[model samples]
Target chain A: MATAAARTFALSAPLPLDNGQSLDGVIVAYETYGELAPGKDNAVLVCHALTGDQYVASTQPLTGKPGWWERMIGPDKPIDTNRFHVICANVIGGCMGSTGPASPAPDGKPYAMRFPVITIRDMVRAEVALLDGLGIERLHAVVGGSMGGMQALSLAANFPARAERVLAIATTARHSAQNIAFHEVGRQAVMADPDWQGGDYYGSGHSPDKGLSVARMAAHITYLSETGLTEKFGRNLQDRDAKSFGFDADFQVESYLRYQGSGFTRRFDANSYLYITRAMDYFDIAEEHGGKLADAFAGTPARFCLVSFDSDWLYPTAESRHVVHALNAAGAPVSFVELSAPFGHDSFLLDVPALDRVVKGFLA
Target chain B: MATAAARTFALSAPLPLDNGQSLDGVIVAYETYGELAPGKDNAVLVCHALTGDQYVASTQPLTGKPGWWERMIGPDKPIDTNRFHVICANVIGGCMGSTGPASPAPDGKPYAMRFPVITIRDMVRAEVALLDGLGIERLHAVVGGSMGGMQALSLAANFPARAERVLAIATTARHSAQNIAFHEVGRQAVMADPDWQGGDYYGSGHSPDKGLSVARMAAHITYLSETGLTEKFGRNLQDRDAKSFGFDADFQVESYLRYQGSGFTRRFDANSYLYITRAMDYFDIAEEHGGKLADAFAGTPARFCLVSFDSDWLYPTAESRHVVHALNAAGAPVSFVELSAPFGHDSFLLDVPALDRVVKGFLA
Candidate 1:
């Protein structure tokens, strides 16, 4: 079951999907750091979030920006690539090299809207196939933050024996109604743009950059805490002493958000955004276990560590506590901590030394 | 100074706006309830928020909807139009019957993109002129919530002798970074729509309803509590038992948000949305008073009552406390309470008995 390292694997076998369809020619793009020790006992799987790619410790090919989790995955970082083998994969519906809507179908055309809708479980299944090919069944740990945390937790629940340690940060066991609502806002923005053209804009003259920019701008606000935005840019005008009294990016926050939106459209695809957000909204772990959260982790032997930020109202500590209570009911050993950080849900990716200590201690 | 009641006042006198521009032929549309009584002592000023109009206790002509604040008005309601002459005006930057972006400019064209940006204080200034024309030397109370609450606080701070009592509910003395961020998202959504046509869509036979709807959907999520949305539409599918596996409004939350967005587009003007949101982003009472919130109300003589909802993270109880501290330091007699309501920031517009009782008692 050993496959080539840092390469794309195409599973030609038909795989069952949650929505009564079977996918063929599934391609999973992945990157591995460090070496798989003898017996593969030192292998640690890292699950990336919605927009993240397999380039966990290197520059992103699309934008040349540093890898999203580079701060936490370097040689001497908490993840400690020097000591353990780390594997990261771009999820199936991602715009990266993964087999997504942008990927070719068996008929040699972009799947686009023809691509099968995927769930968070489906994304995990694709990753698990990658794991299968790596010849690594039982490993050290599964770690992720935000949507990545969802993947890690999913691995622990669905594949109980895959990892001995599970660390999920700034995530929820389920997407809240507000979570779905915000994602829907993004989808609507993308769809409302005529350039989107029902997700068939591939090879078009221009992509739906305006619509994608709006979507990114809306979603970006939810990532950071209100306090963070204020301390960074509060009522400060962009470049004028007096108010312009017209519809220009007057406030510095507006300019910053506009820049973020426009910059995101250059690297991301609009149709991929729609598909991935739908997958997140469809995520409900308890529903997968007959409305019992405890049942989702019942009889699991993996030790769990849950982390939340003090200011992350998006997936608040309350959501983490819900999962912790279920783990407690399931009779599993677990440790939970709510760290103080002003960056809200994005704290896991930021410079939080406390998070580093927590990750190091939990892994140890 | 004596003008007619329950009518529109065309003030040909030049009015200086905050943005170093003078506005001429300012038309303020307002409605009055009950009688002003002799000496005009029983006159009460009730300000409306972002999308509200002068029809606070009457019927809205555009959507055939009831008055926005009918719950707090009426004979035995909190504000009690039975005893006091309650006056509500569509703000200067509003659509409705007010002279706003949709109104004709001096050049005989819809102002559209040419409309000057106005602040919450500018809205208050327009209302103050309406009061001056009505021969009302002083008001019994100035009451508002959300943006309306900003106006109430602004009136108390700027014209200390204009009102005997001030009540601000479900609002902050200044817009938070998150508040401004959310408004910026909406603004970006509108501007991103090519149909917006650089804000000159008045006579184009089509407006940017799609963009405006996306903006409303984003803002509507902020109005309701996450708990409320979870309780109302938690992963419940819309007219289906199984997943659609396509990008339709599968979840009830998506359907609900889409309906909210589309319904809002029918009644609201897109250009006015841009202008009003700009004004709200410009709101900062402390910044107006050299960094001290207390200094904003230092010489105010009006008794104040500040109310906040416990679940409203949008404005939050902490924001109300900051204003209360300022009021206390200003030597203004202030009453403050945090009411428990599941409906987040929109609680002020709903039938929360606690809020009704608080308003009644304070006004009494």
Candidate 2:
């Protein structure tokens, strides 16, 4: 299980979006594990959240850490690559070898802010094209959490017959005002970095690492619950028993957030952060479907399962309930549950036994 | 009422805070209306929110616009200034003729980041000193909304005998995880500005205006509701009728936010933004009161009135409810109400007739 290798695939073709614009010479980075069934009926697609990539079950090339979803994709795991053909791809508008803001434009310069604002639906559309390119007519299941959940739901709504089962965990159908406000803050942090230089820092000899790190740190806190933070740190002194009485990360949580921010800047591009967050802010499936959330799923045939963490303030249980209510209104087959997790909105990414059981059972 | 002239006061004195820090030669820029009764018992102190100064009923010197809290501080308005002495002072650690990061340090240079980190309690402490200097022993009422509300509540909890009545609107007793996250983003923005140069831009040729503007724009969105934004400007084009297909503030809301950002840069100092926001993020009445919310107000004699707007996600009704619940647990006399306001958190600064009545009645 530990040494299992996944095959990689890269594409260089112009993929068209529903908005009529085509992403020219697109490059999709993907990894697949296990063998496909005789009829390709056991294929599962794993969508990644913002900042995640195709290295779902392998060592990350940049950070040398285990794959982000390593806890849920190996043998005997929830997704269980040994039982189902598992595929994961770096989404478009991302920095991990995908066609994104950090990719070079026709002039061989990084796209920077010039990258077209791609939506979650656009990302799903690209994945569908990838599936088509692979000669896979249908998927056994599509599963994801957070931003990934947005993509999963988009696939179910945009390409209903492509997947038999859909699981969206810790996500909302649309960006709430609070969500937008938070994204705006992050975007502003990136733009404020003078090293950013209007997102044209490609050959400028410097990246907005400080600003980007701070942005990530800010966002990371939302992914953690107050209870989790208090239990873990709770104003505890960092490295010393006494308060430093200065700005040297006096608390353990402060040091932790700073470390998270600094580490994130090493793997993520500032421009990609801006583009991806803007895309999230612009997402509104209900508005696209004429202001009725259920209309987005009209006549959907896929069975849906949604999960939310009780402590997640980013996409709370209320948000998941809204999605379930919309699914019920659409008369779609759906199962919804709110799991008790102390990790806030990012609980799905952590080791949650109940989440694993639900995914394993639902997929089966 | 339209042409009511506001009385101004300028005092330079040393202000001492509870933290044993003394700000020397502090200038208190303030504006007031109506008259002070012979007994000086009808004084109503109006505390301004973050980013707000003391021009609560006068035209602003920078923008030549009406004061922010004019709707709630004018004659026959909320506190009925005609029958009470209204006092509004620019907060300490502010940029408007107050002891702040932009003010000259002892060496005759702008303090920049050298300004000491001041908490909300420290701000109230300065106000108390100002009141003492003005020969007022106690306030008839202390009214504030948002960050100002936090100050009013702190005064009631920290200095129980200072205020007879306290009206706190759209505020919380302590900074939440979400609040701290947002403030962190803003602080990062200021620090990321190249011109900031480690917050020593006093003698530098450039200022961190761009970064400060972006931060302000991000924070401004939190003050308005999603419904209010959609109703005012939905996917509407900024000036042209169709999508420009480029990032040029395509939507009216985007342009509006940019305008707000730019305008804010003209009147506010970037370093001051950092200092004030950090102060807010560090504020915790419970932490100062033995890690118990109820203990903060133990044996407080001030009558408390807490108000919240229904759509305010920044400091939502839930937060107000938490404060009220804590006050109730402490056996404090408190009244709580969630008012329906379309403008969200900014409703406190807008023309809400119901808010006016509530404030007047509470103060009376």
Candidate 3:
């Protein structure tokens, strides 16, 4: 049945960060599926996006929903977990049982806003610690989409010997100005809520649900394509024959957005959202490597496969192409494709048959 | 000097709305530049966008800044005041001295949430009343961009004999799902504010400034092209050499957005934003005309001119093309042009010289 059980690993050493700070006693929460080969060479690491946890092929305890990539990671599925051991871990700034903002500090108090800012590379460092803990010296492949793709690329670049194959989908090498701007709006929405109480709302009986919901609503729009929204909702009334002439959710799209916004608050923490989005905004492999993106992957041993969606404007095909150019300059073996999809950036997580083919072929 | 003096007019009768409700004692704020001419044949009506007021060719009283479209509407510029009389009016649901949510109702209390939902056609009806009060039947041309373009199209569709020419720039005949979704996010942000107090916070020594600021920030990003933002603010640090590692606007883009959000709350009303955005979301000339946009302009006398900016993703060139197709099907005299500009949807208001030339030639 390949039912995965959640596990947590506390690091034996402090994890260093690019921001000149170190997180002490870091705990990484992860889930594993399939059986590990005796030689331990058939391992594959799967990364999750902004709001994802490490429930890879299991059910989420909070929402009782299937793991985000369950369709692609089951036995004989595209990822083919029967032949490959799969591991997925929660990022450091994430709130999914990992040592995050909601975790206790040295004083046994919730870190809340006092948690040190961490970068994408810092997240990779924590992942590397998890890999070390698992005693897997090298993985057959590391796969991800969206922010997950950033981690896959980060693994390939910063820790060259960690994985043999790197598959990144609908991701960018660096956050664009528009990307930073959008994340900033989300952060502002979260901070603006009076219930936020400067991120000290932990155990307050009242959370910044309204602010987080607004933040989620603003961000949720960016994940879907304009055409998709038009096709799905298209000015259709929510539940009435005519407009309510009031502030009630009149349009189907508005109703859907409100649902997405309110629903997100139940499973996500506002402070963790702030930190993760900031890390994403600070992500710039080129900046980290003397302003030359090619230098980030210099003499890399990993073979790279990059996939972008034609409708994904959040991280368009141009971004993938830019990364391809850098890989080419670095003399790395790489392949790229821009698959057609109607779901925009969310196409990575949606049912895109071509994506399945690409992932399967790349991992093989 | 082509300085426009602010003026206001009270409608002698009630203003009818599409929502089966009428507003009594409606007031419209306006500004006029140059002379009306002996025959009033040289008069030109200019409609303002959502955030725009009646300060077309004058300094804004609230901020002491030049009028938004001053460069395009001066004595010698396009829509030249020397050659024609120009009048600009604040939409009835606007906060610039117009009868909006902030205005008093028959009970002598602010309308607040009690303001009747208005449509673009209803706004034109108020403009028509204002024109009648001035004893001038619209001649020459009516020009607008964005939401103003919606009003221009509405005037041509409903009051076909009011204007000889209609110039709609960077706009659409109907709001797309994406458009409505973005506006919904903004509205939600405002309504989520604790200080909103169910829209009755007026004179309470506090307003939903944070919520309204967040809304403005979200909208401001849509106003510019991705390329423009990259070129202007890329990942540059904000007045510092390195990231602050804290949530204090480390990036220049974040600083810019925060500044914009905070600054907007100073000169704009929160409830008015809600009302105006609602009106825009409800705009669909085709829906009002038996699901055929061509039918909206049937038997129209005005010559139509539509200009779209190539980089505008908000109301892209495709939207203008859609309107042109409808106008073509209706056998209307319409000229369409896609101008190359890096500013995106705000191209109509920015220094897009091609737009200035088009406005001049079309009006001439």
Candidate 4:
């Protein structure tokens, strides 16, 4: 049920990383709902995107906000917690009680910038370890949207037999150049702040809240389409009869974005933001496997469902098609569909009946 | 031809503004090229967009960079200086040798945040005053792209008989909600910095360079299409074998964007950015005319050519179509075309041969 609390798994051994290094004192924060079933075959793994945490169906402790995907992951929803056990993990390099930039180092100080750079594969590897610790051998399905979708694909490709079904919604196998550019802007914004103090702002009187807010504000625009913004707030003045003729939250859209950015800083660690975005930018599944995308899933037995939105210019339908093509070439069972949604890249997070139907049908 | 310098015309009369205020001691920075014919029928008004100056066909004095529209306004080019007398003026709220936020107030101090908020209509009005000062009765054509296109439309609407032909390229009739949102983000970024000092950073030790750079970086991405960035950078390392596993400029695109952001700070004044962007955000021709877009151009005598780039999602083909439909309803002679270009919203400033053809054909 939604009342579940977050739990953590600590592994004694260091986790090997892709960058020829090992991460010590590994920890994964996770939550589970419903019973695992006698065969442990009813377990579904849900991955989170950048800035997302393990509280998929539980209330977030810090902000008291409902689970990010509550509408789709409820009892009778598409994910159907009543029908299956759902496991969601706060990823490595994540801010939510996971072993990340904010976690203590060997010397009892926060890792901060000293945290080892991680890859998407490393995050999945941690998830696998968490699964192993939980005594789960196989997953019924691996489901995620956006960055979470990347994790779903990675789990299926590298550990082919772990999950029988994979659902990737509004995601891509690699980060596009524009994606990296946007991330770079955010990172620069964070670093530019004098308060950042080279990522050592843990005990500082003030955090890089302003810089981080700007970073979030810049990144937030990409999550929406032009038409969506126009329809929702077409030059609509915010609580004013006329323009203030000065810099203020004059437009409703500006006020909304400001709220999103300010609210993010309250729950997120700036250093973790830097680390997670870096991991995403470095995510190129095919680049690791000889530049041939199909090779990553060469022997995968997982059945995959790829869902994309028409207005998702961030990771458009073409990106999903590329993944489906790779699955086809690898002789894997795959279903691909592009749906119409006006919300753009954030469509997967919004209430879309079509997305719900697709998820229910695929998981069934 | 490129050796011409920017000249200023000081108007003795106060200029009226939409905000029920008047701008006093107005100065218009302008430049002219080619020769004025005996009948003055070959005079062309070239409007500059946001951040553009009067150095349309001349070298920019500040950066030593070539004119922004050198390709279009050169002797042998489409808007050929040899064929027509071209006049380009920096808008009133601009920084380059124009009366703007950085310009002295009536008492001889920089206006800073005290500068009167101007509008697209006010900018066109200033250009009209300049034309009157130059003794030009009518323009053969008024040409512009992006914000320049906004100026072109404003000129045609307010001063209907000033120009015979109006060529607005890769632009919209007014600022969309998304457009205002992006500009708001930039303004916020500028104001977030302590160095901005409440928009009076003139004598400050350092300008809000970091914040301004971040703003430029955000705007720069919108000016480029996804495919263009992917082709140009495509995760290509910037002088490195692999990502440093830290937040350095890992990709070429990041480096390129950083350069654009940082370089822009040296040449641009932060206060001018806020004032100019505010003016753009306030632009709404339809809202001004009893909620009818056609009413803005009801009795216009200008022959219009509307050009949109296929990749320019900022001001997409639909936006140009809205203007064209208005022109049709207004019974104005208008031609509309959507051309293919990979440069997104900035295609008009780039070397697009199709644009050249359009300009030449429209002018002829």
Candidate 5:
């Protein structure tokens, strides 16, 4: 029964946008855990971060690895699939099984750079259409962190009646100056790779893996705190006592980052990284609502819980406080907390029993 | 008169270190301005940052351009070469005619990767030897900014009595976790290039230009701030009205970074980048001095002035405050101020009239 419970579904449908341009032939690669309640009021949607896909509660087809949110989506975990129906889908402009830059263009070749430049709100729109096609109206909660949290907020603002509760963690309502600078560096790294060939490497028997890896490695450092890195790496030599006195990966942290970068290239499309990170950078909830953040949630009834980490310089506690202040000004019921975590901006993905308790309690 | 002013002496010497190892046959590519006052007491040493060389007060030979510190060293500017006998040398482990990975090995081949792993202290030792060879017993001031600032601090701590004053700006006493992580990313970018070939690309006739460019681009981002970046390039299209919907550097910032990266590779050795950044990451003044930051300056009579830029996040005001706190604890005569500058971490290199006034007053 457990084996049969982890089923994925393929849904190809059109998602109409307010801009009058519809995303045609959209394919939603999604997985669901547990069963929808009789009233369909216990449904929960879990959005994924940049580079993440639909395998939030199942194994990934590409890497054959467990879902990225496995720690917080099992039977006894925070989401508690045994008590609630959980749904997660690959976002638009992603490189997984979903529609993305690596997908075929109208000419039948890989889209490469031809894919439309999409925003975080566009991804949420597609997800909402998928939910509509599935004949399931989300009634319980919308929960996500980082870019996923951006989608959660988008959902709450754009479709207030869709969810009863919203949980956003380690997220910013708008990309900060520091965030944009780091993302720009990553984008430059990808573009500098000669193999990239103007992002047309699909049929060239080569990928811009090196540049993408460097970009990933650079971005990865921003996701962690200074203390976390020092505690983990601490100038520790890699596979030797003294320095190699040469240019090998002389430090363990270097080796770890290289592994992360290289492994990432195998599973991700460089163009997708470019598109997704741009979407995140362009995300500005207030800009969408006439430079008034409160207007985005003016009449929203969704109970909100926002969490940030002390060590997260990427989206520091101040960012979360700004969001909370907007929610308060809008007369929306909101609870905010800054938790102590040494993991920096990536604390949402790490082990934090406090976050787990908070999510569980808020959902209940 | 101009020829007489340009006349310089070459000093090649050996530097002995506390570790019993010595850098033999060291070549100090140096340039001096003005005249050393009687007793050589008015001499000032200006160290350069990574990728910087000598010619601090003269036209550079390789680029045929004005010196890097031209703004700070000219008449009526800070450090006032007209008032002090200013000396700037290509640092050890650098490629600007100094002993570095690109230099010839004992066996007549380019050292490539065979060069000894040199630290900041090793660099200071070599500079000390150069000063001795020049018949300078003590310097009125040792001045530098950024990596040059690190060298200035090292000189103050390691060879305290050699200088009466030290000016360290926009620098840190130790590399933070984030600093190390960024350096590691840069190192990986270089090694990932196949042309790097274990740092033996000398005779192979192939330079790891791509890798080195990416590394430089990444480092360049850190040397800037988000505010500075946005003000400079705010999602502006590159030679187009709209996005090409392709990956050809859609933004002006991307194009700028690419230019910086490519230009840097033509002048710098990739191996030197790896070596120097590693040495910087390994630098911890407190760790080197019994885990007591004050002990590094204890009993040292060197006057200190630490300057920081308000918008410089790479080495923020907090980092300068930490150093100032340590200096205070050591009873060192120190002057500290955070200058308001929009140029971010690169403000020291930019035209900041306030910085010039402070430097002139402090050095005087």
Candidate 6:
């Protein structure tokens, strides 16, 4: 069943960004599950990943697909929306009913490349504005995974009083060189597409689908564990007894990745992909707080719970331990665990019973 | 100090391929170093990796750069060219003077996508033909790393008596699902470019350089270890005091990757990249030998040495161990070592002093 209708809230004033620019007339699109308590103390904010939107426990409007975290957000699920109000919003540089590069500028044209570059902290500022408009000065918990995990950490660090408990899964406080390198490849792929037309392809009939698909294909590989891929596809042929000795998808894994890539282009905007990835690349909480991670959590009252998947090379358990060590140095209440999973960085979005238990227990 | 000039040998007959097809009028491009023994037993056949050429111990004509294995070859080096006759051949699908997609087809046009797909064994077959042309009955050794390693393994498995020793470094006997997935991404990136023109970019004035650059960028990341990247580039800015808040290469890693991507497009052919990577993905010695790896090495008299880098996730030590186990099962003499190096799959190409000793001792 459809869980909740999408809602939007416009900030009364410009939202200040880390890049020394202000985003004007910003509108945050969000979805809520369950009801807010009378004291507004039972509100939980769930941030989405790089490509995720606001359909936390409902069907996505564009793809008619179930919410990314549908398995963990319903009644009696890990998130347990019946017990607490759950809110999820599309990030600022996103395209899903949010103010982003696809939004119209003062000239009544899509901002396209003119969209101000954003950072993880800038996204949090927009989220905080949304929270302020909702009359919720504090969240019972701020929870996320991947890019969302970055946001969870950002809110806890920047707006220390906004979240009482923070749960960040499979994430890092700083984007590594490898991470930036991968993102740069994707960006270059999109920009290289003739159809991208300098990111001004809003109504040009043709978009950088080919390049975006390639970008998605590359990113999809990072989301999966080598063991998981070997177990699922191996050297299996793609419905052929012998290789066609051509450029076609001969291996099942190749076919699967191609499908993943092409399907992604149908629902994503190339410009938004660029903007979001740039935001992630600029994320460095330690650097933001005078180059000391411990200083980022100083005087924060939030109880932090960090979870990592063993197979996630993108944001490995070592990154989580780094954060935990910093929290320890900051004398903050923090709990950390590296759960075993074969899904890599996508484990948080996949069916991992251990992750479900961790989320449920941490929230409780 | 010019080691040798390139030479080409035309196969006397059509070359039989693994896909039941035949390649006609094939020409193998190669180079030689040092003097051949009167008995020809001092001959060493070196197989170059993807994107490498026959300029093994000389300056590459196209880029004016020293050979890929320059440090490991030449007089007094580990391979000791002064004491052994070294021969390196560009593979069939390569872009050098070899017969490849860029070469003229039967109709006097570039083969483009019409070129038949090749396998690692097919590549070994070509090398065997080159040896036959040179009047060499057997090789003192067959040496390679990465895709080159695949060819060395193929030579040992398919032509057991042709080589007295086989040295394979930082490679796998079979392309894992992850390996195939990454290659597939690179392939898709190339094909997505309009300039690719279905691999018919030859003589088209413009090539799919953008797409190939993106592909190279992605592959470049897999070549380096995370720890190495952190130590080399980290989140350091690129000649700047602050973030640019734009799509420019603000991070040093991004700038480095961009330079690498652009510089590669100059000296490489996109169509050759597609064909070579395809050959690599199709590599599966176990499958080629009735689903048993040991069967591939059955009765092989060659002494084998397999080297892997501890940080090489692309083709980790486990893959080498698998080959070693199979060699043991076949009662073949085999030695394997996983050297501690931070360079990942590129460790074999980098300066790792331990590797030099191992290669010298193995060849001796």
lDDT of 5 by residue, B85-172 (tens): 8888888778777788887877888877767777888888878888887889889999999889999998988888999999999998
Which residue pairs clash within candidate 6? none
Docking class of 1: medium
Give the C-alpha miss distance for residue A336 in model 2, angstroms. Answer: 3.0
lDDT of 4 by residue, B57-134 (tens): 888888988889888887878887778999999998898888998888987888999998888999999999999998
Q: List runs of model 1 lying over 4 Å from the truth.
A: A1-6, B1-6
**All candidates: TM-score:** 0.97, 0.90, 0.99, 0.99, 0.89, 0.99
lDDT of 1 at A278: 91
Interface Cα RMSD of candidate 4: 1.0
lDDT tens digits, residue span A60-103, model 2 = 88999998888888888888877898888888888887788888
For residues A1-364, could you state the per-residue lDDT of candidate 1 as single tens digits? Answer: 1111457887757767788898988888988887788888888888887777788887777787777778777677788877888899889888878889999888898998899988888888888888888889876999999899999888888989899999999999999999999999999999989898888889987678888888898888899988898888877888998567777787888889889999998888888899999998988899989989899999999999999999898899999999999999999999999999999788988999999999989887
Chain B TM-score for candidate 4: 0.98
- Go through the candidates in order and give each one's C-alpha lDDT: 0.88, 0.81, 0.93, 0.90, 0.83, 0.93
| Candidate 5 backbone clash number | 0
Task: Compose the digit string of candidate 6's lDDT tens values, residues B1-364.
Answer: 5378679999999999998999999999999998899999899899999878999889999999888888888899988888899999999999988889999999999998889899999999999999999999999999999999999999999999999999999999999999999999999989889999888888889899999999999999999999999999999999999999999999999999999999999999999999999999999999999999999999999999999999999999999999999999999998888899998899999999999999999989
Better of 2 and 6 by TM-score: 6
Calculate DockQ per candidate and list them. Answer: 0.77, 0.30, 0.92, 0.80, 0.43, 0.94
Model 3 alpha-carbon drift over 4 Å, by segment: none
Q: What is the lDDT of residue B359 in candidate 5?
A: 90
Interface RMSD, prediction 3: 0.6
Worst 10 residues of 2 chain A by lDDT: A1-10
TM-score of chain B of 1: 0.97
Per-residue lDDT tens digits for candidate 2, residues B258-295, read 78888998898887788777677677788889889899
**Residue-level error in angstroms, candidate 6, position A281:** 0.3
**lDDT, residue A185, candidate 6:** 92
Candidate 5 per-residue lDDT, tens place, A1-364, comes to 1111333344465566433466677776677887788887888999999978878867777798877878888787889878988888888788777788888877889887767778888888877876787676865999999999999999999989899999999998988655766787788678768788888999899998988999999999888887798898876768896555455677788888889999999999999999898888778898788989999999998899999999997888888999999999999999999999888889998898899999999988
